[model samples]
Target: MTPRPGVREYVRLIALGRPPVGWRTTDVTTWSLARLAGRLIDRLVVPRMSRGTLRRILREGKVS
Candidate 1:
């Protein structure tokens, strides 16, 4: 999207969004290393993103 001029303009910027979910089956306090920016970007339905590009987006958005 390259909407970094002010990414917060593209979508409602949730600087820190929800975290990943985990299911230990025996515990619910376990979380993975999922540093996935916590909703830095919305998971679009029309197109999917590649890790590399997402990284670039993060770099451009200065959210990295």
Candidate 2:
């Protein structure tokens, strides 16, 4: 089955940081600093995320 997103999936959007131009995800109604933080915490419990890693992923992230 497709791993669909729920209230929990918004966190991946955090992994997204500032939304990578053409990037998109599921289960979203708005954008707010507080909301982003909440979603990141609500869904995927990313223990530690670094700016450098985020930057690298932005550079090397796979595309279809």
Candidate 3:
């Protein structure tokens, strides 16, 4: 099975999707890192991400 990207990776890519360059990071503290992780799983990295094993990949601390 393949792996998924992390929160920092997600944020980095999504941020990279934007222009001007300086608006890369965010301060969204309302959401836990896990929730951000889940969002990165479900939204950005799913379907093309292989299987439905985001939680396992995350717990394993490995990202493709």
Candidate 4:
């Protein structure tokens, strides 16, 4: 699977004043400080989910 871009990349893309093609913003206040913190949490959770999925696949011979 392709790696998802991290929060830093997302910030840089927004800083450029143009979100990359296909970008979607779920939060209404994309530039808010709160959004940054929320994204940080999201970044942390995503890796754990990926690792869990990988472990499941390896141990069970298929992802659950």
Highest lDDT: give the candidate number.
3
TM-score of each: 0.38, 0.31, 0.28, 0.26
Candidates sorted by lDDT, best first: 3, 2, 1, 4
lDDT of 2 by residue, 1-64 (tens): 1122442243444545553343243545444444444444444654443444434433343310
Query: Where is model 1 poorest over a 10-residue stretch in terms of lDDT?
Result: 30-39
Off by over 4 Å in 1: 1-15, 20-46
- Candidate 3: misplaced stretches above 4 Å? 1-29, 46-64
How should the candidates be ordered by TM-score, best one leading? Answer: 1, 2, 3, 4
lDDT of each: 0.39, 0.41, 0.43, 0.38
Residue 24 error, candidate 2, Å? 18
Q: 1-64, model 1: which lDDT tens digit per residue?
A: 4344454333223323334454222333422223333334345421343455556655555754
Across residues 1-64, which tens digit of lDDT does each residue of candidate 3 receive?
4543464355445433333222233644243344444555657564343223444444454432
Tell me which of candidates 1 and 2 scores higher on TM-score.
Answer: 1
RMSD of each: 6.3, 10.5, 8.3, 13.8
